[model samples]
Target: MAGNTDPLSPRAKLAVTAGRAAAAASRAVGRGSGSVIGGKVALRLDPDLLARLATHLDVVLVSATNGKTTTTRLIAEALRASGPVVSNALGANMPAGITSALAGGSDAKYGVIEVDEKYLSTVARDVTPKAIALLNLSRDQLDRAAETRMLAEKWREGLAGSKALVVANADDPLIVWAASSSANVVWVAAGQEWKDDAWSCPSCGGVMQRPGDDWFCGECGFRRPTPSWALSGDHVLDPHGSAWPIKLQLPGRANKANATTSAAVAAAFGVPPQIALERMYSVQAVAGRYDVVSFMQRELRLLLAKNPAGWLETFSLIDPPPTPVILSVNARGADGTDTSWLWDVDYTRLAGHPIFVIGDRKLDLAVRLEVAGLDFQVCEDVDEAVRQAPPGRIEVIANYTAFQDLRRRVGN
Candidate 1:
């Protein structure tokens, strides 16, 4: 048998197959614990993985409470206009997922990965990016993220020793503070303004008054400097009561921030503003984040609500309550280990009767809706709720896991 051996091509194929199977098995075993989020599993790897990947190409990291996925996708798309770029298109933001993306795209010239707030420190320490885009910080995942300030501090410490160019949202107080402390920083400001709950002076804990379009601390006199790249001079045409423009492809004020941030990052990479604007106009919404799909002769607007800030931003974008709203909430560990944050959401803005609710944890959402003095019907089946909802103007609010299930069931 040894004398008859030749190139051994069959054995080589078998070895590759076995290696893939082992990796898949390891991922499955790792997911048995409670560390991973979304469908991606987290696993430890040798430090050489990052070193090997870093030698392949430059990396860009985008992180924020909201708009990270959209901005990351946009930046990746814009970068591809020049050359090949690799990204975590499935909304993976943890260290394991980042490693998986990099390992999978060893040949790509550029890598763009969105990092979650809680995991930014870990990612920053592991992956030394060429540039880091730090979007605004907001109250999110209260259980997982102790507080916005704590996350900010972790981020500051994570990037303190790195040589990455920092692109920050200057309008955000938290980001402004981080930018001021960083030696190499580019500030990007969005023209649109809203009264956020957490915009205050980081140094003195005083109210940061908006003097004109810019924000300044009334007590301490600290203020954000004018951005190097700013999006201004356009009014959001709100034909409906919502503060969103009717002309936008994505229907929300939050999307404006995403668009402007994307433009800024693209411009930083030397893409012209006109090209960025055109790209923004042509961009499509990712699945489950303000994704509007047509099914059964009606439009199903699926918005993913993860935390109180996200819910508030989404609620502010919805047009005046259409008749018969369909709201779904799931308490599955995949969606969220705890559903107590539902209490912080203001469901009273849902101005209609008999709101249809569906999910494994419909009772919890129903209880919250009841406490808010809203009428709702508890349906365990999402398909049933989708079918039973009236034909006129349907808005489906789903948490992370339920959004995917709802999309699959609704054929969108």
Candidate 2:
């Protein structure tokens, strides 16, 4: 029902048509959702397709090392209270996928875009989003995506002088520096679990001082700002001091933070916080993340953790001791070819769980687990790993590509 309302130029229309055909062919051939390829084809036909398609819509861009896809989905669903909303719901954050998504939902009143951390500036320049959500910044895909501070600098430079309202996490120093340059910004006290990458001040390069919950730079005097919205335990407090209990179908503290941010962004677009939170409580999963599906006669709770920061959050979400945990890692290009980051994860926290390692980089993970003094069994695949468990239900934590492969294999 979401279609384009504005009349496109002759070339853009042809590009959209060609992109849809390419996507259809990809789905027919089982190569996957053809979103990237279709967008590639469409862009080849019209280089300015994204900018052209994004015109005349109130757009919101969500970018973060983690939770961008889930947050994007939540924002889109909440904005549905306004009208039909379009989004790249499959976790495709690049420009091509975004263009394809916009092309398909041309008539939708609102566009919720999930942008890659590196591509945020480019997409923002094209779409001119009404509100942009800047979640926490952490080290992820270091082989390709730049370090956290560098990304923060890039975001700061790119967003300078932009008129869009920025809703950013106040708990992260890197995010604080990045969103600081925006003219109109809303800071949310969404807690940051991974602090290793932000020890030094991004502003004056001074050693950051952390006294309990407050963080400040000794040299430059930059400190955590007073947040307009904050997450307190399971409740979200608005700037006016009213507290609302966050009841989301999604589990984990990370998702509660995401919901708080989503509520703030939705409010920026004219939806009230109460209404936005109510609308987001129904989203049980995003793409394939956190999906509990039946696989090999055992209930498998699939969790995606691609970096140390993600793994830290994932560790808290898994089943407790005695419940078997399967950790999958892959060194595919999508999962970051350099598996050295595996050493950064504290696998010893998974000490008591019956841990099983699987995937292409299972041996690499095994070595890290060995160094961490944890016992783990190396398995060939998910079925083999699940077969070794005592049946009933098991937890499976995987990196990006491995997560996708498992989702496809399990038909989830």
Candidate 2 lDDT over 92-211, as tens digits, reads 889989998998886788999999999999999998999999988888877898988999999999999999999999989999999999999999999888899899999999999999
Query: Number of the top candidate by lDDT?
Result: 2
Q: Against the unseen true structure, what C-alpha lDDT does each candidate score?
A: 0.67, 0.91
Per-residue CA lDDT of candidate 1, range 168-272, in tens? 887788777755666788777654343464577776889878777778888998888767665443432211212222134776667766766666666667775
Off by over 4 Å in 1: 1-45, 191-200, 210-213, 233-248, 294-298
Which residue runs does candidate 2 get wrong by more than 4 Å?
1-5
What does the lDDT read for residue 50 in candidate 2? 93
Screening candidate 2 with a backbone cut-off below 3 angstroms (N, C-alpha, C), the clashing residue pairs are 3-107, 4-106, 4-107
**Ten contiguous residues with the weakest lDDT in model 1:** 237-246
Cand. 2 Cα-lDDT = 0.91
